[model samples]
Target: MQNSLQGIELFKASVSISHQENCASGTCIDKNLLENYPPELIVGFQLLESVERSGTRRFAIHCGSADNQQHNGLLAWVFNTDLRYSFKDTSSASRSISAKCAMKVFYKHVANVQPLVNPDLGMPSVTSLEELRLPLHIYHCIKTVLEKSTSLLPPSGRKFGEWEIGLLDLESA
Candidate 1:
């Protein structure tokens, strides 16, 4: 699996892709790479330098009373590998340098495609942290892509969910 969610919503920084061998970003669709892609196409993720790993990489999406006793923070860590691309700290996410090639999705700086399984569980790749903490559009986009392609899902099967859930349905804890 190579491509994941790549685009911009109003709230977060932009996510783009690199077509270079094993750049684990996005792919071409009608000559446009703007469309999303799968994880099988993922290669090695670019590691973020210490200076680049600053600020609110993780965001508070929903404060809750469900999923667990309370759901607070989601640090959606997605990335690719490119040693040449340097980064600088910036408050504005829009103007921020592309960390797409800096962050190793699972926090590893290795330039190799690592398994997106829970470090603890190790198998039957359930809906773990790898799929957590993302924008609405990006989240939905990943579900759609995973449905079409052979990717990890809950142990029950390929179903993402029996019904759709909105933010309002969540308990505001």
Candidate 2:
């Protein structure tokens, strides 16, 4: 799932960060975020991550004042399809945010995973979690084994037969 988005580039787009009616009762956490705030004609914002709940996808956006100026690293979430991939308008007017602001996009921090001692090898070998590939078939196989292993109440404390492990050769795929 994570691999599909590798090397993707950020594109500029617009979205309505509006106040839902329920947000007006002050019962909302972000109800006050846009209050008394003048809308800018253009604002720099970055689409960060997307989290799905039930069946709907809610996307996270990273927002802050332009880098040349002072701005708070504030975050906002939009629930719908991606704003970057589609264009829509008129129903909800998109507000440009900032006071004497320049639009700037901020990206989430990313770093390489560090190598660690492999538990199976005890003190002898080192391994990287990134090197291990959990393909769908293998994942389901392991999940089935685990489900069977823990199916009984109190777990039964039983040991299973020797496992057949296989590697997915990316070159073949």
lDDT of each: 0.30, 0.25
Q: For model 1, how does the per-residue alpha-carbon lDDT over 64-84 read when each residue is reduced to its tens digit?
A: 222233333333333322323
Q: Per-candidate TM vs. native?
A: 0.21, 0.16
Candidate 2 off by > 4 Å: 1-132, 153-173
Residue-by-residue lDDT tens digits, candidate 2, 1-173: 23455553332222235555666655564634543311111111221121222231221222321122222221111222222211233345674332221212211211211112112334543221112122333323423432442332143332223221111111100
- Top candidate (lDDT): 1
Instruction: Give the number of colliding residue pairs in candidate 2.
Output: 2
**The 10-residue segment with the lowest total lDDT in model 2:** 164-173
